[model samples]
Target: MPDLQRTRDPERWDEEEPPTLTTDVTIEQPKTIITRNQSPDIAFDRSINAYRGCEHGCIYCFARPTHAYHGLSPGLDFETRLFAKPTAAALLRQELDRRGYTPAPIAMGTNTDPYQPIERQYRITRGILELLLETRHPATITTKNHLVTRDADLLSAMAALGLMVVNVSVTTLDRRWRAPWSRGPRRRASGWRRSACWPSAAYRSTSSSRRSSPHQRP
Candidate 1:
C-alpha cells in the first residue's frame, strides 16, 4: 500500500515499469513483519512470511489466491514468479526491540513456506531465524521442505533452550495418488523429484504397501 502510486492523470500509469516477465529476484521492504492473528485454533499472535509467492508449483496450494492483489496470474505466475522481503530480517528485529515488546512465541511458515526454493538464494528467512536465535525468542515453524535441515544447528540449539519447535507437513503417503501430483513439477524443476510425497525407494524397498485413499464426501 505504501509504494502504490495514486494519480488522477491516467497517462502517468503508462510510464510505470511493468513487472518483469519472469524473475528469480524481487526485493521489497515491507513496513512490518509480525501479523496479528485472530484464528481460534492457532497458538500464536504473530507470524513472519519471507516471500509472497511460492515457486513449488503445487496445484493444490491454498495460498495461490493471494497473487490476484499483485495483478499476477495465480496459475503460472505464482510458480515462475515470486516476491522477496529483503528487509524482513531487520524489520523483525526492530519490532522485537520495541519499548513495550513482550516476548511471545512467533510463528513462521504459517501463510507461506519460509524455505521455499528462492530462499536458497535470497536467504531472507535464514537471516530472520538467526535473529530469533540470538534473541532467544520462542518460535514454531511448519514447512514441507527439507531446507529447514540446513538450519538444524540453530533449531537444535533453540530446542535445547525450549524456544523452538518444527512441524513438517506431508500431505499424503499414497504412492499412486502422490505420483500423479508429483510428476507435473519434476520436468520443469530439478532437485524436487526425490522429495516428492511418495515414499522414498528405501522405505518402499523395506516394507509392504500401506497406502489407501479415503472416500470423498458426497
Candidate 2:
C-alpha cells in the first residue's frame, strides 16, 4: 500500500463542518492475543490490544501507520473502520495457563487506545482486565480516554494487590487543541480528574507530546 497523507487546518475547524463518517466494525478471531516484543526501547515485553483501529481519530496517532498493513488507509479508514477481537480474553487465558508461563506486566493501549468508544459496547477490554485480576497477573494501561474509569472496580481491585498501574495520556491542555488534535471529546481536565479517583501509587499522568503547543505533532 502506498503512503497516504491527510491534513486539516485547526483554524478552519469552526468555519467548516467536518465530514460525517460512518464507523464500521468487524469481529476478528485471532489465534492469540498476547503480543510479545523484545524491543530494548519499550519497558514491557508483552501486551494486549483488544481492538484494532481507533475511533478517537487523532491525526497524530502513531498507530495509524499500522493500518496500512491491512491494505487500509492510515488516514480516515484508520478511524472510521475498526476491528474487535471478541476472543481476546479467551486467548489470553489460554496463554497464561500454558506450562512455565512466567508472569510479567502485560501492557494495554500501547498501540491503540483500549478504552475507545467501541469498548463500551464490546467490553473486551473490561473482560481482559477481569481475567488479569482473577489470575493476579500484573498489567499496565495507557490511554487518553476517560472510559477506563468505567472499569474502576476491576482496576482498583488489581491495584490494591499491587498488580496494576494506569497511565492517562494528556496530549494538550488547551481546549482549542482538544477537538482538532484528537477529534474526541476527552478534555485535559477530565483526564486528570478521572485519574485522581485512583490511588496515587497506581495512577500516572503522561504527555504523549513533549510540548503542549498546538503546533507540536505527536
Candidate 3:
C-alpha cells in the first residue's frame, strides 16, 4: 500500500485491489501491566492496556498515532494488526501484591479499547477485573463494545463496594449516525441503550460533558 496521504515522495503501486482489513492479533508478554502516569491532565495515576491496537477502526481515534512507533501505518495497520498481553492478569497480581500497593482506581481502555473483538479470545480484560475484585481494588473502564455486559457478575460486585466505574463510549443516540469505522449493524443506535441496562447495577456509567463532533449533525 502507498502512503498517499502523509507522504509526498511515494511511488509504489502494483495495480492490485487493496487487501481487505482482517484483524491479526499477536500475543505479547509484557514485563508489566499497570502503567503509571504523572500527567496533570489525566485523572488517574495508574492504568492498564491489555492490548496495543484496536479493531474498532475508528478513523478519528486519537490513539492511532501510537502505531507509527511500531513501524506500522497509523491508518489500516493500526486497526487490522493488533497486540495482546495475555499475562496482564498475572502481572497485575504481582503489582498489587507488592508492599505499599495502595488501593486506588485503575483505569482500563486508556490507550485502546479493552473490549475489542479479540478480547473474547484473550479474555485479558475480564481476567484483570476478576483479580481486582478478589483484592477489593478500585477499577474504572471505558469501552464501546457490548461485551462488557458479559462481566456484569464481577463488575456489579465491585460496584457494591464502590470499587468500579464504567463508561460506555456512545457518541450519539441517532440511529443513522454511523461512520465508516462503525462496528457492524449490531452496534446500531439501540446498542447504546442496551449497554445502559447491562451495567446499571454493575457500575456507574459516566460520560464527559463534551458535545458531539462539530462535523456531525444534530
Candidate 4:
C-alpha cells in the first residue's frame, strides 16, 4: 500500500541538497604566542601556529580532532572553518621582551601550517619572522606551500647567519592521490629543493607516511 501519511506530510520525505562548504574565519586574540613543549623528542621547546584549521583537508590529519573543542565537526568543519591569530607577532615580541627570557630557535608550523593560504592576506607569519630577524632570534619553519619563497630575501639573510631553517614536507608525490584530501595540487618537491639549496635553507623532504605519530610512537 502507498504511504499516504508521507504523501501529505512533505516534512517526512522532502529531500534537500546539502549546502556547499565555504571557508570562514574567526579572529582569535591569543594572549601568548609561544607554546612550550616538554617532550624530549621535540627539537624545539617553543613554537607558534598562526592559524588553526588548515585549508588542506587531509582526511588523515591527526590534528583534525582538535576542532571538536569549538563545537564543530572534526571532518568538514576542521577545513572549512578556521581561526587566525592576528596578534601573533605582537604577542611574541611581548613575550620575548619579558625579563629572563632566553633566546632559542622558535619553530613555526608545529601544530598547523603557518604558511597556509590565508597567510597571504594576514601576513602574520611574515611579521613574526621579521621580528625574529630584527632581534637576531633564530627560528625554524616547516610548510607544504611554496609560497614560503616570498620571504626568500629575509630567510636567506638569516640562513647566512645560521639563524634559520625551512623544511618542506610532502606527504604523497602522486598528484592523483592528494586531490581528494588536498585543496589543490601539492607543491612539487623539485621547487622546494631549489628553495632549500638556493637560500642554503636546512630544508629536507620528509614523507609523512614514513613517520609514526609522536603520541603513538614507543
Candidate 5:
C-alpha cells in the first residue's frame, strides 16, 4: 500500500498545522448487490452493503479488516476512504425480477454501514428500500447511524406488511468514550427518538453494556 498520509518537512512541521484527513468516496458499479452466505453461524443468508467503508470509525468494527483487500490500511484509511454502489438498487431490481428468483429477508449493514455519513448524499440505501417496497420484499437492517430514521416512511410501510426489522447498535452511552470510539454515529438519546419514529416496526438494540437497552415511547 502506498503512503496515504500527508508529510511535511521537519522545519515546517513546527510552523504549520498537521494536515487533516478528509473522506473520499469512489463509486463502484457492481454487477450484483446481494451477497449470499451459507454460514451456520450467521443468521441471514443474503445481505447488501451500500457502502464499502464505514465513516463511523468504530474501533472494534469487524469490517475494518476488509479494507486490507483493497491495499488500504485497515485503520485510518478504512474510515477516510470509502466506496459507494450507486447502481445497487438497479442491480437489485434486475435480480429480484429474475425468472426463478426467491424472496427472503435481505440484510443490510452486515459488512459495512448502509446509512453511513455518505448515504446522505448518495441515497443508495434509500433507493434500495424503495425497490424492496415496490416489490413487496422483506429486509432487515442493522445500523448505528441515526440516518436510518430518515427512511421511517419506507420502514413503517414495510413493517405494516410484517416485512421489515431494524437493529440499532449502541456501543456506549457516555459521549466521553463514544466520541473517541465511534466517531460518526449520533448520541444515544437522539438515535432513540429517531428510531422510535418507525411505528409498529420491530426494533432491536445491540450494545456492549447491559445498561444500554431499548427505549420505547409510550
Candidate 6:
C-alpha cells in the first residue's frame, strides 16, 4: 500500500464520509501473508504482521491509522478493535516452499506487535517461528512486549545457527507512560539494562515523539 496520506486524498473528505466500526472485532482474511516493501530505509524487503489494530494501544503507534481504513477511530478503536489472520503461518510456509524461493531474513512486528496480549493464546507468532526454525529461515522481530521471552528457547537455538535476532522496544522508563493511550513501558532503568544484552543492542525511544500530539476524542 502507498503511504497513508498519499492514499487518502484530502479533498475526498468533503466528497465522502469515512466508514465507522460497528464492533470492536475485525476479521481480516488477507490473500497474502508477506508484504513486500522497496523502501530504502527498511532492512527487509518483506514482512509479516499476524494481526492488525494492536491491543497495546500505544498512542504514538504509526500503525494506529490503519484501523481508519475499516472505519474505526485510530484512538480507542485501534486498541479494543482487532483483526487476526489465522492462516498466517500456513500462508508463510506455502510462500517459502514455492519454486525458486530465495531465503532472506523475514521481519515481523512491523505493522503491529506480533507478541501482543492476544498472542499468549493465539500463538500465531510462535507458530510462524516454529516454521522458520524448521526451514532454517532467517527471521527478525522487533517488539515492545516481554512476552517474546516465552519463545526464548526457540530463539536461543536459532541464535546458535545465526538465524534469528530480536529487538525489544523501550519507549519510556516512566510508569506514567503506561496507560490506555500507551502499552507497558519499563518503569525501571535496570529493566531496560537487562534487555540490552539481547541480540540487538539498541532500544527504541524512551519517550514519545515531541512533535506529535495525542489524538484523543473531544
Q: What stretches of model 1 exceed 4 Å from their correct place?
A: 1-23, 174-176, 179-218
* Pairs with backbone N, CA or C atoms under 3 Å apart (clashes), candidate 6: 19-71, 171-206
TM-score against truth, every candidate? 0.69, 0.81, 0.77, 0.78, 0.81, 0.76
lDDT of 5 by residue, 64-117 (tens): 999999999999888899999999999999999899999999999898888887
Model 4, 171-199: lDDT tens digits are: 56666555343433445454465466333
Model 2 TM-score relative to the real fold: 0.81
Q: What's model 4's overall lDDT?
A: 0.75
Top candidate (lDDT): 5
**Candidate 6 Cα outliers beyond 4 Å, as residue runs:** 1-24, 179-198, 206-218
The deviation in Å at residue 8 for candidate 2 is 14
In candidate 2, stretches whose alpha carbon ends up further than 4 angstroms from where it belongs are: 1-17, 179-188, 197-218
Tell me the tens digit of each residue's lDDT in model 3 across 1-218.
Answer: 96668444345354233345678888898899899999999999999999997987776688999999999999888888999999999999999999998878899988898898888998989999999999999988887777777787887788778788777666544434433444544653344454453333221222555453211211
Q: Give the candidate order by descending lDDT.
A: 5, 2, 3, 4, 6, 1
Q: Residues 1-218, candidate 6, lDDT per residue (tens digit)? A: 85565365686646432333243555567888989999999879999999988877776789888889989889878877788888888999889989998889999999899987788878889999999999999988977776777787777778778888776666555664554433446432333344443465335443435432222111
lDDT of each: 0.68, 0.79, 0.76, 0.75, 0.80, 0.74
Off by over 4 Å in 4: 1-21, 179-186, 197-218
Clashes of each: 0, 0, 0, 0, 0, 2
Q: After superposition on all CA atoms, how large is the RMSD of candidate 1?
A: 13.9
lDDT of 1 at 136: 94
